[model samples]
Target chain A: EAGVAQSPRYKIIEKRQSVAFWCNPISGHATLYWYQQILGQGPKLLIQFQNNGVVDDSQLPKDRFSAERLKGVDSTLKIQPAKLEDSAVYLCASSYLAGGPNEQYFGPGTRLTVT
Target chain B: GESVGLHLPTLSVQEGDNSIINCAYSNSASDYFIWYKQESGKGPQFIIDIRSNMDKRQGQRVTVLLNKTVKHLSLQIAATQPGDSAVYFCAENPHDDKIIFGKGTRLHILP
Candidate 1:
């Protein structure tokens, strides 16, 4: 079976500019997540979606970042007026279920470089 | 807030040697713990996981030991190989739902 898919393996943008990333989860997976991985640090959860509804987004910067999973399938994450600190790799993962210890399959990730 | 942390930032060992990486979690409520290996430019891949009900779990050449008493966790690799060189991360899920990842430890295997 195919793994989770993400677009624009790499991106470079200037501060205050807008950037968006896309993710297509594994077939039949019921849970999807977005994470930000800064250099030398582990990936941090930004948002989580179970089907088309959000499950958690407490860490997300509502003022600058937003994400949506439309039709309970593909999803998108956007960071507007990007800041230099936003330069990090964005990862997308999917799981077979919404809970439990089920393994999450991750994509290659989109490396965002904000100047 | 929930957080997972590693005891070491890096570990180096010779081929055929056993390697152990350690981690600690702050949340006592976390019932599930997982280990992931990440290679350069690649995303993290799951290695193994353990639940609060179990103290130890083994998979392939890897073993995960969880000590809920002290809130410590460990991953042991037997007869480490060159392919094992990568960053290993430990994550905790307090409610078996959302996951929180540790800083990770970079493992280096010498020929």
Candidate 2:
């Protein structure tokens, strides 16, 4: 009955620094996703996981961004050598099924600022 | 190369009035659509959804209309309140799996 949970609602880092965000999804949910929302834009899918296996990560910046969903319950998204363009809100969401029309429950996103 | 986009970037409406937000999608294969509301500091929350088979669906205070012909989607909010002030986004799922979100429409309710 608890919704998805995320840590460090806000974060600030200098360019070239590294930052990581954590997410704990709702119980029994099998699909977890990470998205980036720039100011005045919609959330863009960064990665998606289904029970510890990556379902999709076509938009993820492989050179600078990485994510893992170990044990299939919690997830962590990391960005190394952050750039000014990386300053955006990172949102986490979970759904009950891996492939369905089920609604996704989102967590309070982590707002990251790179100086 | 499918994308979802909104017709309006922002909409202003008087409180107690109704609001209609429109979106267009390029993927004709999309079978599912959803509307989400996001506050200033929070992530998007699900408002309502409509499947491609159905032309319309209604919730407590929200209604979603889908037109497969023109690939158009719309959300109607009845008796809009101050709480309805937020950014609304429409997402499309081509295969009923992965979803693509629109840029979003900022809704401002004037009291």
lDDT of 2 by residue, A1-115 (tens): 8899998999999999999999999999999999999999889999999999999999999999999999999999999989999999999999999776788899999999999
Worst 10 residues of 2 chain A by lDDT: A96-105
Q: B1-111 in candidate 2: lDDT tens per residue?
A: 899999999999999999999999999989999999999888899999898999999999999999999999999999999999999999998874687899999999999
What fnat does each of the candidate structures reach? 0.72, 0.78
What TM-score does structure 1 among the candidates reach? Answer: 0.97
Per-residue lDDT over A15-115 for candidate 1, one digit per residue giving the tens place of the 0 to 100 score:
99999999999999989999999988899999999999999999999999999998888999999989999999999999989767688999999999998
Off by over 4 Å in 1: none
TM-score of 2: 0.98
Model 1 clash pairs? B30-B94
By DockQ, who's the top model here?
A: 2
DockQ of 1: 0.76
Q: Residue B11 in model 2: shift from native, Å?
A: 0.5
